[model samples]
Target: MHLTVLSRSPAIYTTRRLVEAARERGHRPRVVDPLEVELGLGERPALYHRHRRFPRTDVVVPRIGLSVTQYGLAVVNQFELLGVPSINGAKGIAASRNKMRCLQTLARKGVQVPNTVMASDASKLRQLVKHVGGVPVLVKLLSSSDKGGVMICETLESLEAALEAILGLGQNILVQQYLRGQDLRALVVGGRVVAAMRRRARVGRFARSLAQGAKFERAGLAPAQERAALETARIVGLDVCAVDLLDADGAPLVFEVNSSPGIRDAEEVCGVDVAAEVIAWAEARFEAPPRARATAARRVPREA
Candidate 1:
């Protein structure tokens, strides 16, 4: 089988791991930057990369980054239009990219999530904070990734300052209840929790992202936690993703759903062959009959 990985660079840890995994499984793998993919439209939609028509691909695995979301989604959509199945579809990726949208979808699907509110009026900032449980609330850009546009405001003054800085730049933001407890990340693949980790923020910092110097250790998820993580991915319409949950009292409250989750940390901490699992899942779909494959492709939610 031939697998195509949509990524900015083949040097990226996750991309490299996937390439290695595919090759180990006796499959040909190619990494293409979504930005470099040229979409052609006519009687038949097509894609061209590096000035040549893209070759037939058995399956696509998108490692789209937050910075290139729009173009990346377009590239993924083009693949779908051409009947090329992808592990994660364009709608799922788009939904996960927008933090608020992801939370809303999960909550609507009866999954628990942190109390979050979005508004454009700065005059109602205090009310918005109160709605989410008050100061020390989280201020987040609607479409941030890797903890880029997230802020912890411990006071009204700070909340106001953060809001001004974000909204003044014309970016949408969400105010969420800041629940203090265990910070957990679960990597879900094909409706199963394949790896889990507990993350601790660096001393003197509130963010618990590995990129922010956070330390993580292998962790086991409670049945409920595992269920929530699985449900979050399904609700967001992704076959593979990472769900971030914060323990609120004894219950877990999902805070984020990452579509293109980085597997390096989870793989290292959990000692799981996450890349291989991802490849295997894609291979299964690739091996399905044409009718079954189309059915599976349509199972992934389409952008409305």
Candidate 2:
């Protein structure tokens, strides 16, 4: 099988690992920068890269980054038009990128998520804060990656300042209830929890991103936590994803569902070849019979 990985660079940790894993499994693998792909439309849609027609591909694994989401998704959509199946489809990727949409989809499917609210008017900022449980609430851009667009407002003054800066840039934001508990991430592949980790924020910090000097370690998930992670992926229509949740009290409250989750840290901490698991799932999916594939598609719950 010829597997194509949609990534900006082959040197990226996850992308490189996937390429190696595919080769190890006896499949030809190639990395294509989505930005370099030319989409052709006519009687039959086609794609070209480097002034040549794109070669035949059996399946695509998208490692789309937040910075190139729009063009990246377009490239993925073009592959779909050409009758190529992607591990995570365009719709799923799009839904996951939009924080509000991802949470709404999961909540509608009966998954508990942090109380979140979004508004355009700054005049209602205080009300929004109260709605999400009050100050110390989380302020996040609707389309953020990691901790780049996240902020914890401990006071109304800080919240107002953060909102002004973000809204001034014309970016939508979400005000979410803050849960003081363990930050956990579960990597789901093919409806199963492949790996799990707990991210601890650095001293005096609120966001638990590795980029923010957070520490992570391999963690085991309870039955309920595992179920929530798997269900979040299925509801979002992603074949593989990472579900980030807070151990709110004794229950799991999902905060984010990452479509193109970075597997480097998870692999190191959990001692799992996450890239290989992802590739194996894609291979099995691609080789499934038509009836089986149809049934699998039907199993994905629709968003409200």
- How does each model score on lDDT? 0.81, 0.80
Best by lDDT: 1
TM-score of candidate 2 versus the correct structure, residues matched by position = 0.87
**Tens digit of per-residue lDDT, candidate 1, span 1-27:** 778999999999999999999999999
Sequence-dependent TM-score of model 1: 0.87
Cα error, residue 34 of model 2, in Å, equals 0.2
On residues 132-193, what C-alpha lDDT tens digit does candidate 2 reach at each position? 78866777766565457877665667676776666655566688876533779999998889
TM-score of each: 0.87, 0.87
Q: Candidate 1's error at 159, in angstroms?
A: 4.6
Q: How many angstroms is residue 243 displaced in model 2 relative to the true structure, after the best TM-score fit?
A: 0.7
